[model samples]
Target: MERSPSAQADLRGGVIWIALGAGIAVLSWRMDRLEHMHVNPYTVPGLVPGLLGAGLVVLGALLAWRTIHGGALARVAAPVGVDRIGDFRVVATGALCILYATLLIGHLPFWLATTIFVFVFTAAFDYKERRTAGTLARGLVVALIAAAATAAAVSLVFEDLFLVRLP
Candidate 1:
């Protein structure tokens, strides 16, 4: 039976996720073990990433299975309307991610880069809605707080707690 376009897209996404996760697991597993330092097994560099990769694999498998054998595959629904605004948002988000990775990482400290990215991302997405409601300032304040909190948490957790150096 022919699957809907959304189901097909889900299947493709699931496959991609599985592939990406498998790659991450493999690479992470091959990372330095620090045998000389005799680090605890739980503290191995690959431990967390390997778990995350495994999680992705499991989730991807579920997505693919659902797409293949669940209601999405069984139904014969009409084509859904496409939202151009949603598409624009996706493109805009992707552009922001690209900018963060390419331009922000090396030039700025991790916390600062993260702060800017999160703030811009939040503000950019919420600007129109907040402006329409005449609450742009409040939205900006909220976004800034969220951005600062995220940056601080990430920096503290990774650098101070986990001892992982940030770029």
Candidate 2:
């Protein structure tokens, strides 16, 4: 029974997730409840987050267990090379999201910002698969359509259906 690199990585990641979830649950528990306002106990500020944290902890533990002793127990003759491009894309997407949330949201109109973000993100990722000029142009068109459609759907859902304000 040999452990693959993925399994070892998963075991490590699962432990981190378990710790993060527990910390979230603890913080949620320590949050103040608006007893003076006679807010319903079920409607406590931390209720949903607390439940989510507990769920994360449970799932993380299960992941760790499975990686160490379950399907990941299969033996492998050689380690595979890490996908640098894929990793870069993941980090880039995360950074793009953070920028969109922190810098773009209020600075630009919500629909416009969302459209631009989606367009750029889609084009950047899509370029990996099809790098030719024609394909790139087609990808941009596709990205534009996707961005417009997504923006419209989100605006309708939040503004009309949910009645929530967009930044």
Which candidate leads the pack in lDDT? 1
Give the whole-model CA lDDT for all candidates, comma-separated.
0.89, 0.87
Please provide, for model 1 over 1-167, each residue's C-alpha lDDT reduced to its tens digit, 9 standing for 90 to 100: 24346876788888989998898889889999888999887799998898898889889988998888866657675567677787799899999999999999889999899999999999999999999999999999999999999999999999999999888
Off by over 4 Å in 1: 1-80
Model 2 bad stretches (over 4 Å) = 1-80
**Poorest lDDT segment (10 consecutive residues) of candidate 1:** 1-10
Q: What is the alpha-carbon lDDT for the whole of candidate 2?
A: 0.87
Across 8-92, the per-residue lDDT of candidate 2 in tens digits comes to 6787888998999999999999988889999999999999899989999999999899887855556562456767776797899
TM-score, cand. 2 vs. native: 0.53
lDDT comparing candidate 1 with the true structure? 0.89
